[model samples]
Every structure is written in C-alpha cells, then in structure tokens.
Target: MHPSRALRYALTLLLLPLGNALAAQVQVAVASNFTAPMREIAGRFERDTGHQARLAFGATGKFYAQIRNGAPFEVLLSADDTTPGRLEQEGAAIPGSRFTYAVGRLVLWSPTAGLVQDGPDLLRKGDFRHLAMANPKTAPYGAAALATLEHLGLVDTLSGRLVQGENIAQTHQFVASGNAQLGFIALSQVAKDGRIATGSGWVVPTDIHPAIRQEAVLLTKGQDNPAAKALLDYLAQPQIRALIQSYGYGLE
Candidate 1:
C-alpha cells in the first residue's frame, strides 16, 4: 500500500470507536398506554439516528414521583399533559421542553364479541360480574374511566364490582385474560389500522371524560443530551405523528 493510503486507513480506524462513543443511549420513562407505539418508534429512532432509547413503561403518576426523587430518566412520555407540566413547574423537567405528543382515547373493551355495546347502557345494566379499570390515582386513563363512570351515573352502582390495575396495560390484561368480563383501556391497546383488532369495544365519547392529552418532556437529566433531544425531535416529525395516529390516538 502507498504510505499516504496506509496513514488514511489508520486514521479511519481510530475514528470508529469515537463515533460509537458519541452514540448516546437515552433513558426514557414512558406511560404504559404508549408502550406499543413507543416500542416501534424507539426501534426506528435507533436505526435511523444511531441513538438508543432505553425505555421504562409504567404509570405516569408513579414515574412522576420517581423522577422527583432523583430518577435518572432523560425523558418522560406521560399519559397526561398535567404531569409533564407539573414537572416543568417543579424543575424536574427542562423548562419549555414539553409538547403534546398524542391525544389518547378511552375505550370499554371485552374479549367476548357483543359483550360491549355502542353506548354506556351496558355499564348501567350491570350485566357483567366484574369491570376492570386502572388505578385512577396512578394512571390518566384510569382517571378518565372514572370520569366516564361518573358522567354515566354508574359510579355508585358499579363500584362494588370494579377491579383495579396498577396501570392501563395491566387493566387491559385483566380483561383480555378473562379475569374481568370487561375493562376500560386506552384505544391504542386494542386498536390497529384505525379499528379495534379483536373482541368488542365501545369508543367512549370525549364529553363523558376529560380529554387525555398525552405529553412528552425532556427531563433535567437530559437537558444537554443530544440523544434525548433527537428522540424528541423524531417524535414530532410528521411521519411519526401519522404512526401515532394509526395506533388509535389523535394528533394535536
């Protein structure tokens, strides 16, 4: 090999490790309702940007407490806008770094066909032995479900038969596994290609419950992290917004 070519090859080899070193891995705390879509987006992000997103899925309220107590998460994808806003106010998140990512829809779901009707009458009729919902204190979707029950005047009558899950994902499992005849869950949990994929469900009206405006924010730990910023930017892309919508969420 020529002397110049040999020096150039050596330099290229030396820079390879440095490139790998700069590829950051961001720690993200994600809401359980966004589990599926986040997984897809995270994979694409890593592939396209050479940055990894290490995700932890759980209840938004619980994640909020953890972040406040010094959790090392670089980003927070909360199920409700309130939590992210509060984090900004409390200095847990970077100021003005928050944005609405998706609008979540609440649904009443059952594994059995025709078990859920188009309206709220089924909940009032009390035909099912049990109804599952996430813990309202921990999950936004759970809070929405409660609001819906209250709006339909079923809270007093159905509280006795209600089963609670720690998060919306678990609440979905409870109904999918037949542990509960029916359950309230995020539409994303059971929807695909703009429709419910299996079983039966009622798309609860917005008026019945408060809007589930999901939001994402950069945490204090991620303020200077390039990977964290990249993920946030990637989420705001039109293609990604369309992908989120395909999962049964509305886009802002």
Candidate 2:
C-alpha cells in the first residue's frame, strides 16, 4: 500500500472506538401517562443520536419524592408543569433547563362502546356502579379528574362509587380491563391520529379544569451528561413534536 494511504488507514483504525465512546446512556424518570409516545421517541432518539435512554415510568409526584431522596434519574418528564418547576426552584433540577414538552388532554373513557354517550349526563345520572381514577394526591391527571367532577357538581354524588389506582397507568388498566365501568384518563392513553383508537371516550373540555401542561427538566445529575442533554434536545425536534400531537396532545 502507498505510505500516505497506509498512514490514513492506521489513523482510521485508531479513531474507530471514538464513535462508541461518544454514545452514552441517560437515566430518565417519566410520567406514566406519557408511556407510549416516550417509548417511540426513545427508540428514535437512540437510532438518530447513538445514545440510550434508560427510562422509569410512574406518577410524577412519586418521582419527585424519589428524586429528592436521591434517585439516580438524570432527567424528569413530569405530568404537570408544577412538579418540574418545584424541582428547579428547590435546586434538585438545573435552572433554566425546564420546558413544556406536551399539553395533555383528559378524557372520560370506557371500554364498552356507547357507554360514554354524553359523559357529563352519564355522570349526572350516576348509572355506573364503579368509576376509576388515579389517586388525586399522587397524579396530576387524577387532580384534573377531581377538578372536572367539581365543575360538573358530581363530586359528592360520585364519591361513593369511585375506585382509585396508584397511578394513571393502573387507573387506565382498571377501565380497560372492565374492573370499572369508566375512568378519567389522559387522551394519549387510548388515542392516535386525532381519534380514540379503541373503546369510547369523551374528550373533556379545557374550560372545565386547569390545563395539563407536561414539562421536562434536566435534573442536577444530568447537568453535565451529554446523553441527557441529547435526549432533551431530541424531544424538541419537529418530528417528535408531531408524534406527540398524533397521540392527541396539544402543543404550543
């Protein structure tokens, strides 16, 4: 081989491991309602950036406690804007690293077709034997559910018939498995392409409750982690934003 060409080949061999070195893993704590879209985005983020995201999904409120107690999560995608802001203010998360990633829509859903016709009226009639919802203290969606119930003046009436789940995912499972006649859940849980993918659901009006603005924040643990920064940046891409929208989340 020619000397210069041979030298170039040797240099290429020396630099080959750098590619793998540049790839890293970030630990993420995500809200349960964002499960599906986050999985797809994580796959794409790995493919496009060569970095891996190690994800843990659960209630944002629980995640906040875990983070404060020194969980190893480098990032948090909270179900509500408040938790992330609280973290930022408390110094658990890096300042100026938080942003709203998705605006969630709450829905009254049932696995049975037509059971949810005129959702507000159905609640008014108190016909269902059981209604499921997440634990209001630990889940933002659950809080919204209560706010909605309060708006419709059904809180007292439905109080006796309500079932609570530990988190939004489990709450959804309750309704989906027919354990409860219906539940209040995030629209993204059973929706795609601007429609519910299965079962029947009534998209609750924005006027009834506070907006569900989900936020992402880089935890102090991720401040210097390249993969953590990469993951946050990937979430802001137009393609990822479109994917979020397809799941029935609103964007600003």
Candidate 3:
C-alpha cells in the first residue's frame, strides 16, 4: 500500500473505538430518595446531550456496598455525604469527585385519611398508635427521624409506637398501607417543588434534626465514561437545580 493510505487506514482503526466511546452510555447507582428528580434529569440529559444514562435506585448504604463489591456502576448519587466521602478516601470514587447535589428534607406524612394533621403535636398528644421511620443504621432519613425524636424528647415516649422501615420508601409504604399511622420520610417521596400532592404532611424543621445533606460523586470506574461526566455536569444546571428544589430539597 502507498505510505499515505497505510497511515490513514491505521488511524481509522485506532479512531473507531474512540468514536464509539463517545457514544457509550453511562450507568449510575442512585439513591431511592433521588428517584423522581433523577428520572426527570435523565430525560433532559439524554435529550440535550445525546448520551444515555441507566439508573438504579436503592438505599445509599446498600448501593455503596454493591459498588464496593464490583457492581458495574459508573457514578453514585448518595443520600448522604459520608458514603461518598468514604469511597473517595478509599480511592473507589474519583479523587475530588464529591459534591452536594441537594440537601434532603424529611417530613411527617400520612395518606389522606385525616388521621394526623401536620405537626409535632401528634406526638405530644399521644394520638397515634404507630409511626414508621427508616432504619437509623443505614438510612439517612431514618437517622434524621431518630435525631428529631431525640430532640423532641419523644424517642422514649414513642418507643412503643415506632416501626422501622429498611429505607424511606418502605417507611412511606408503611404509612400508605395503613400499617403505620404516620411516618418520617424524605419529602421528595410525597411532594415536589414545595407542592404537596395527595398526602397531608408536615415539613420537619431542620432545627429538630441533623440535615440530610446528600452528596454525589463520580466513581473512579467512570472516569472515562462520558455519560457519567454528563450527569455530574447536568446536575448543576439551573433548570435541573430548580427542579431539584421543587422537590423540597436544597440546591447546593
């Protein structure tokens, strides 16, 4: 072959995978607490960037554990900072990859049964038979509820009435199924953008508990992945930030 043609063919072979890499999709492990907004953001990202993102949601702790065990996740959107920070420290996450995407809020919510009005008064009055909270060990929302109750001096009072869910979604399910009279859950589960839907809820005061500051990070495994980078960047856009805020979360 002529020298120019041979070089051109070799370059084309090398460039094919690079072009394909640019079109590859990114897979993300997202927290259940971020389910709604992430779904919305994913749609916008795909539409705007021509990049696809596949999402999987569960408790942040569980997701982190899975990622550590070699789950094929490119990014992690955690419900708290600790997990992502730890991953970064361990070099599982990309160095300096962590940032707060949103600050989560918790609420005392009940389906429209009119059984519980929105307030801390329900606890003081001893009006409810059961309350659902996430498990304080692994779920950030559950830990917040525990802190809130501890602040109110109601943990001892409600000890007999408390029911714990593995995560916020289960806590919400308990309330919705009428298995629990009320529950402490992430605000995004039942409302968005300062708007409440079918359920009646009381926004738990930030003073009552530690803030659920959720942080996200790109995994080291995703460094070369465009979809992961796109998502991390997509999260900071004004429109996406506004949508996140609408879901009763604070924009970072």
Candidate 4:
C-alpha cells in the first residue's frame, strides 16, 4: 500500500471508536407536559453533543410504575419533584441524582373564544357540560388542577361535569377536540414565545395549589451511562434553561 493511503486507513480506524463513543443514546422518560420543550432540547443536545435522546412522554405516575417494574429508561423528567424523590427512596433511581429543572404553571384553557372567562367563575356557574382534566391520580398537573378546584370550593360541584384524560397531553386534546369545553393544562403545552399560542387561558394563581416543581433524575439504569449524565448536565446549562423558560416554564 502507498504510504499516504496506509496513513489515511490508520487514521480512519483510530477515529471510528471515538465517533461511536460520541454517538451514545440515552433513553429518557419525560412527562407529557414537557413534550415540546424536551423535543427541542433533545434536538439541540444531539446537535451539540452528538448524543441522541430516546424519549417516552407520558404521565409521571405511569413512568414510576414502569421504572419500578424494570423498564429500560436511563433518565426521567417528572412533572413533580415528589415522584423522583420516591424513586430515589425506592432505589429505582440513583440516590442524590435528582434536581428541580423547571417549575410549571397551570392554566385554565379553552379553544373557543368567550367560552372561558374568569376561570373560577366559569366553574362556579357549572354551565359547561364537560370540563376536562388529567387523571389526578396519575398526573401531577391533574393533582394541581384538583387542588385548585378544591381551593376554589368547586370540586364537589364540578365533579359531575369532569372529564378525565390519561395524561396532561390528552387533557389538552380533550379541550382542543371539543370533547370538553375547557380544561386545566400545563402552560408549557399551550404557550409559545411566552404567550398563549391559541385560544384563551387564565394562568392559575400559584397560591391555589402546591407548586409544580418538575424534577429530573438519573435512573438506576443510567448510573454508569455517560450519555445520560451528559444529558442531565446539558439541561442545567443557562442557555437550555432559558429555552425551557421560553416555553412557559419557570426556572428553579
């Protein structure tokens, strides 16, 4: 072989392993409320680091059960801090590997104009046939919505009219598809560029419910995974945090 050709072949062999190392994939279980921002962040992560993220978006409660049952998630981005804490205690996640990444806001949203005004008053009147919300037992956003209703003294009155979705994403769908007149959804899902992208919504007062402190954790399956750790670190970057904030989430 010519000396130049031999040198080029040697370099290619040496670089192959490094390229493979940079292309690691991390499997992440993310809350449905974080779907949009996570997608954007994952794209940026892949572009910037050459590490890919495989995301599964759903209810945190469901993810918890799956993780406990040996699901193959390397990381979890929960809609509430409680779930990650519980996972850490249960040994489903790495101890002390969790941190609050974002604080989420809840909103009473309606796709139709004039259908929702003075959010609490609309509930008090109980004029709407179907009011959508996520399954409070499975979704933190649902729990927050329920807490807000309880705070407003409208839970019992509105119970009969409530329509439950499996997750926050579905809750938004229920309202958007006209299956329900209005619903409580994560601000991140409906807002873009710091404003509601469509329909009308009222940002629920924080005092009405517990703060939705969203957290991210390294699952036990990811303890030794460099890609997983890198993704977590990337999420904490100032630029990434700003991107998350622009999607209607507050930084912790």
* lDDT of candidates 1 onward, in order: 0.90, 0.90, 0.82, 0.88
Assess the local accuracy of residue 19 in candidate 4 as a C-alpha lDDT between 0 and 100. 72
Return the clash pairs for model 2, or none: none
What lDDT is reached at residue 118 by model 3?
A: 45
- The clash count of every prediction, one per candidate, is 0, 0, 3, 0
lDDT of 3 by residue, 135-155 (tens): 988899999999989988888
> Candidate 2's residue-wise lDDT over 1-252, tens digit each?
234434533443454467878778999999999999999999987777677999999999899999999999999999999999999999999998788899999999998988888999999998889999999899999999999999999999999999999999999999999899999999999997968988898999998999999999999999888788777777776788899999999997
Candidate 1: C-alpha lDDT? 0.90
lDDT of 2: 0.90
Candidate 1 C-alpha lDDT tens digits along 110-168: 98988787658888788889999999999999999999999888899998999999999
Model 1 ranges with Cα > 4 A deviation: 1-18
TM-score, cand. 4 vs. native: 0.91
Return the clash pairs for model 1, or none.
none
User: After superposing candidate 2, which stretches have Cα over 4 Å from the reference?
Assistant: 1-18
Q: Clash pairs of candidate 4?
A: none
- Superposed Cα deviation of residue 177, candidate 2 (Å): 0.8
1 or 3, greater by lDDT: 1
